[model samples]
Target: MHDLIASPFLNSFVVLRPGRLEGIALPERRFRELAQSHGSGLAVPLWLTDAARSRWGIDVAPRPVSHAVHIRDAPVYGHSRASWEINLGCDLDCEHCYLGEKRFAGLDAEGKQRLLLILRDAGVLWLQITGGEALINPHFAASCRLAHDLGMMVEVLTNGTRLTSPTILESLTTSRPYRVTVSLYGATAETYDSFTRRRGAFRRVTRGLAAGVEAGLPLRLALIVTAQNAHENDRMRGMADELGIPYKEYTHMSPTIYGGAESLASQSPAHLKALERFTGCNAGHTFLHVDPHGRASMCKVGRDEQIDLMAEGVEGLVRLGAIADRLMLRTGGCSGCRLSGLCSVCRPLAKRYQEAKAPLNTYCQHEQKGDSG
Candidate 1:
């Protein structure tokens, strides 16, 4: 069997033939030299190599390894990273929930397993099992095990409410998710419960995070910013720090996927611009999000345009690609605009403005300055 190791520092993968361990983190020049001398292997990204190995096992050699690099730059349909919302029945009813009050009806266990197999066949190496609360789904652990057994790396997104249960904790241990990200709404119980509208949820979530940490699972903390808990952001960071876990903060808020204008306040313009500069939607290109019912879209915000995964199976990816291409087009006032470079307004948000006939000023500072051509 060919041995492969991933180097996060280099953002590359090293291929070895059994006993070729010259140590890890080799410099690029030395790595290239080794690849040249080895004749059978080449340098490639971990995601590409992992996908290949997962799909084809040892039978797939490292020939023309350079092609893998383009997987991120120019993804091939059906061969990219994916996230599936195993179930949308989240326990928390936060005001900023993008899904709104929509009831979730997902595939049965047999059908979900079938979907995983289809994704595995389609070359999806990285899969995230998320939910209203993934742990709340009876089949979540089974799904994680299935993804892992299929050679896909699994990540779980949860609010941490149900994670403290003994049964759930045991299931998580067995399924062995690569990482578990807990959403921290507030640093204190009062703010958190107020945001979720569920009393005692904060205590439960914190306990769940502690349980995962005690179980030796890789844990990450994410703080969801909203008008209600904006003041608690720093305290939440401090809480994550106290827990000794990596933390991320996000401020973007959108109307519900069902187009409900619940109308919570949004982040400030300066904050939005700074955040947008660093983030871009990767939807159809290299990433896809699947809802509980198996509807696949480029991203959460782009859910309006979707392909029913159960109906199309692997071929759904092609339809999604076509949809993404159309969606990526610059429409309305955005087309031929000189400030498009500085504008953080993406295609999906722009489409929202076009449909609502709202001025771009609502979404873009540049547009507010009359920069649109």
Candidate 2:
């Protein structure tokens, strides 16, 4: 019943009660000593009772404590945020879409509401609604309102096409989404159309950004980099500056969730290699991705293992954690590699290469070059 906690993101442990996480930070060494002395049987740093009393205003008392569950041993459910793909439909057809040609009939309005309730009851605080274009869904606004009513923060990930319509704009204003993230394919109509293959989409999306800004809604812009539009990265940043909206750039692209590599040709191997190591994946730990048909997985990249949410509900979600725990890459190649720090490749992607019987040429090449030098 002690209040020490470990942070997956910070790689550091802290002592605090739930919902009041602002507590004293303990050095890893001190924490480990306390944990060992207390026989907590957990790896997290101990509560540092003396330091807690003087520095963090924590009340320290001597009391016999029972066994402590390792933070990693705790169930992922009710602990992390989630990303839900409300629908698979989109107005623009980007060649690099991870979904590829996969399609599914999403839940009805009632079903979506029920799902939202379950997520909220499960202690999921943040719900990111995404899709080929979430705003285009018929029940998009209503779903946002429902999520808001249920005490979950709602973030809408959209292409921005539907936001330009007055009716849609009105609904968005009323629903008051916590935030809206618009994906900008390119900086101009020609470049955007080249990537999206949808004429006039760039104009619609830009207009949508303006409307959202004018409506006083929080908006974030993300430039999706591809071979066709990679050269326009600067222009995309300028566009975001011009609009005075927060923006980010995404350059790495994963093979389609369906295992199609058509878009892989456009990805830059060097750029991919230079990418930061993915430390916290949404998978079984604290995040889940539910596709249109209610099939939930750890994340979009690792959707190979799935559980039917509609069929199993929360039980299905718990099963997903079990599935992710059991997912491990083949050992020989990556098991003990010293280049783990420099290598951005993950188990799921490694498994994909193994299945294809193709060595991860980029990674192997980098390793060879490093060894030679």
Candidate 3:
């Protein structure tokens, strides 16, 4: 594998290392030239060679384009990003998991390969492979390798339980994803294991994290703060700080994907933080999500409408933009709500909250206004 990856990120171009975070931006013209030079046996430009050497300490001199560079071609589709759930299987069961019922099921090998290629053809440059615990998926290594070979910057969303496995570590070290994001439950085993309802999970996760850091893998942490472990919030932050890993905290717990209120029970009533303003998002316009069965949706939360990739293939994504539009409309319980414009949650999320019959204070400003009779 080449030490660096040169690819088109939507309308722009980037030159980045596979396992490291540092990267360089390349002008479109330069990117086109490099891509077109592949078959011509043209040597890589000195500018890139110099940048790689100075920035990443890798030498690419005296090597032709075919050998030195892996330039990914621009896609024919307009979409640029996507996330896929390889499977719903998980080792530990967290109380706040949005996927309430974690079924260990997904597409077979042939179906997975087909779905990945469809993602590439649909112009997904940045892909996130998530799961109940993505690492536990039997096909994870081969599927991850296929995604990289397809020229997509892959990020694995894992639980960190398997990061210490020699086979898993070797696979990741070899192909090297752009990032491996691990979820942080708590600072101590008592809190973590209790929150996940699994014994010895905290030790396994810490060991995995240590192994990952030692291997110089690009790792990020997602601090999941829930009622079960909210007291350790400070300790969790401290752990990330001590590890020198960047982290984002998730304080609010949402309803399950199946519109059940099970996950909301785990919300930390006193610790819930105000969410950032919900400016509009480009869910289906620029990004989409796919379930394990190759079913595509506007995003993770907005799964009301879906496209069956296995049946219609990538061309089916043409309808995703329209689905996004319909899903975002202020209909159903939100219809004519004066606070629609300032609502903290999107329409789809609001719909899920409505379905779950969650407390109004959890998602709406309407609760404060009451019904003005």
Candidate 4:
């Protein structure tokens, strides 16, 4: 990765460092000047050199623009963020996975590279690479490196089971992700292993966590509270505390993305937290999601309409905003509901619950409505 990444983020321009959360915004003229300077073999600007020294404690003196800065081209699309499921495969089988069936399949190395370039060209500044477990994918490291080199800050979502692998650790520490979020199932070995149905899972995860912390990775914990592991919620918090890392708890459960209700069986009834009121969101307007097979959707929960990226390329994204609008309409079971305004989830998510025939109380506040399908 270059020392700094300069790129256009929708209407604005930004400079970011890999693995760092902080960023510097630049005016359009200044950004264009840098681009021109790089093209003309001019020296790096003093302002950027000073900004690097003060903000990140790095001295970039007398370096050419081509060497010190990597600039990205502006995109036709206004999108600035996206999430891609690199592969829908995991090492452990958790009881409440939203993916439902975790199959090992996705694009090949060349296809993956093409997709990343498409995302870069689409002006995706922040990209989340996820999976059944992102680390298990053979092309994950290469993808991460390519994304960083292309001026996008990457975040990886993993289960922490493979953090102990020297190869995985070296790859991440070298290229570095802005964040690596790991799922925390339980505090104890028995509870964790039981929940995931994977023997020795807790041991491997703990070791991986230690390795990540020691390597000074930007790590966060996602505490997954379910019926099998709800009793250990407090202990799980303590575990995150002991590691000196930040964490967030997930008490509510949703049906599988494919509208399968099987994953809901693990919901902890007593521990379910009230969801925040649903306001508006930008879903397909400013962000998009891509499945393992290079299918792009509005978001993870609202995937009724998808564009096959491998088939149509980034040009396929042109129709996504319209799809988002259609999916948001209150039709079908939600048509003319008295309490539609107070619903906590968007239409696409509520549709999934309805398809799964989930308990009304699990998602809806109103009493029984006949034939929601």
Q: Which candidate achieves the best lDDT against the true structure?
A: 4
Residue 99 error for model 1, in Å? 1.2
lDDT of 1 by residue, 48-102 (tens): 4455465435433354443222111111354557888888787788887766774
lDDT of the structure predicted as candidate 4: 0.90
**Candidate with better lDDT, 1 vs 4:** 4
How far in Å is the alpha carbon of 13 misplaced in model 2? Answer: 17
Clashing pairs in 1: 90-132
Writing each residue's lDDT as its tens digit, candidate 3 over 85-168 gives 999889998888999899998899889999999998898878899998999888899998888777777899999999999888
Give the Cα lDDT of each candidate: 0.68, 0.66, 0.88, 0.90
Cα RMSD (angstroms) for every candidate in the order listed: 8.0, 9.9, 1.7, 2.2
Q: State candidate 2's TM-score.
A: 0.73
| Alpha carbon deviation, residue 135, candidate 3 (Å) | 0.5
Candidate 2 clashing pairs, residues 3+ apart or interchain? 31-45, 31-46
Q: What lDDT does model 2 reach?
A: 0.66
Segments of candidate 3 deviating more than 4 angstroms? 368-373
Clashing pairs in 3: none
Measured on C-alpha atoms, candidate 3 has an lDDT of: 0.88
TM-score per model over all chains: 0.76, 0.73, 0.95, 0.96
